[model samples]
Target: MSRPHRPGSGIRSAWWCEFSTRTPAFGDGDERVLLRAQSAETPTQVMVWIRLAVRVLLSGFDPRDTERAYHWLDHGQWEAVARLADGEPYAFTAAAGRTHVEWSARPVLFLPLAHTATGPLGRCAEPALCACTARGHRCGGHRR
Candidate 1:
């Protein structure tokens, strides 16, 4: 079994994601914990975090030219959406979860789990992701 998730304490701070191509990499639980410390709730602290993120990501890009890029960790996976040399849309995602991450070129509708699906705790999935997108988490698939 996996270790229980404690809130904003211990090594796990709910869930954290970095937008870098390297450094922490994806699925590194310890790094996730470290990144969570960025929640300082101040403008300066937030700016520092953003600068760190930008420095890490820019380390991989060409300095002489501008390139469109976006990357972030989602549910412990590193997701990158960028344009190729030919300017074609490209996206890649990888995770340590049991259910394969599914994406489609065409728009896809995802259904949410019924309220009854969650027990009394209402933790059908990661309570955070549930409140936002329909993505499930850490449950070995089956939509949590």
Candidate 2:
């Protein structure tokens, strides 16, 4: 019913960052999951740090850990932007795929650095904050 946000900026494509999620694969009443990004391929030596914002309505992990996990992204270079309990098995593997942006479980209207083929998406006032809910209206943004 809802779609996840996608970013089309060169940050993930041109710069070569890959995004993926980790979730439990076995029986569980409770579990931890994580969504993160890494350099699948890049030419520059300067590390590209991702500012991940989790807007999930409900997560398997502790809700209190959400905001704190978001800030953890700033401190690490291609590390777990989100943390979840490892009690569950995960088959997730980070693959190099081109995208402009992405969301965890729901679609969101994320700001792009520039205008895309679809249309222009305004930049987020907070540099660290890129995800937003534009209701049901299309915001004309992509992650490729």
Candidate 3:
């Protein structure tokens, strides 16, 4: 017989974001699904934006309209997803707990760009038109 496939065995540690449109109480909608991750060693701006997008999406989720709401994985919750990934169930819970505590202690400041007369003058308005430069990425400065 073949041994069960193990997930996350290659990576030492990582940060994962999960979203679900169902509640545990009902046990019907997709729950504890692993969505994406950021390496523990180096995190990129794109991954940070993905996390921010999750936050924004969750904030706007209306359970009343969809009959379910989405949420991110945090606060010592990781067993179900770990099982699905075929990793040590408690590993994620422990790591996520540590990460949660660490982040709660030191919160990053995020400032949204100010809107212009036409519209936001940054990639926040039109990402496709944004240009990459030596210094950093710059917005196309076009109105939507």
Candidate 4:
């Protein structure tokens, strides 16, 4: 088995995010099933807009529509980032806790910024799985 990546720096920790597909099993076996998220706790409209604006400013206009942006994130960027960070590899799904994470990307997939723990993690420092950099190795910072 592989060891979980520990965040080494605050910025790295803040950048990497994760979600699991396993949900608490409920009801009888026949009726029970892993529940997927229905909606996001808070939508990613603002973040998406900011990212899009930055992209446009840096590059140029993208011909894709809004949904495309969401898909690109849900299936593309988010997955790549998680994989780099060694996050549990699983599709976007919610648990019975009723914690719904929609869009499965960016602001939606990312844990709320407030949950971050301050200070260094000592020897168990969280590893950074930076996508903007090279392979999924510790670059710096922590988030979980």
lDDT of model 4, residue 76: 51
Task: Quote each prediction's TM-score.
Answer: 0.24, 0.22, 0.21, 0.20
Model 1 over residues 91-123: C-alpha lDDT tens digits?
222332221121111111233444555443344
For model 3, where is the 10-residue window of minimal lDDT? 98-107
Clashing pairs in 3: none
lDDT of 2 by residue, 1-144 (tens): 899988555443222233344344466632333234222222221132333223232232354444444444345333332221211111212211211122222112243365678776543322232233446543335221
Q: Say which prediction, candidate 2 or candidate 4, comes out ahead on TM-score.
A: 2
Q: In model 2, where is the ten-residue run with the lowest total lDDT?
A: 84-93
lDDT of 4 by residue, 1-144 (tens): 999999644332222223223323466432222222222222233234334443343222233333454565456555444543453322332222332222233322433233337654353332222333335545344222
- Checking candidate 1 for backbone clashes, the offending pairs are none
The clash number for model 1 is 0
Q: In model 1, what is the error at residue 31, expressed in angstroms?
A: 27
lDDT of each: 0.30, 0.32, 0.32, 0.35
After superposition, candidate 3 runs with Cα above 4 Å error = 1-22, 25-30, 38-51, 62-144
Candidate number with the higher TM-score (3 or 4): 3
Q: In candidate 3, what are the lDDT values of residues 1-144, reduced to their tens digit?
A: 999977543424333332222224354543443333222221333234334444445444444322221323342223333342442212211122112101111112223445789865755442132223435433344333
Model 3, residue 130: displacement in angstroms? Answer: 27
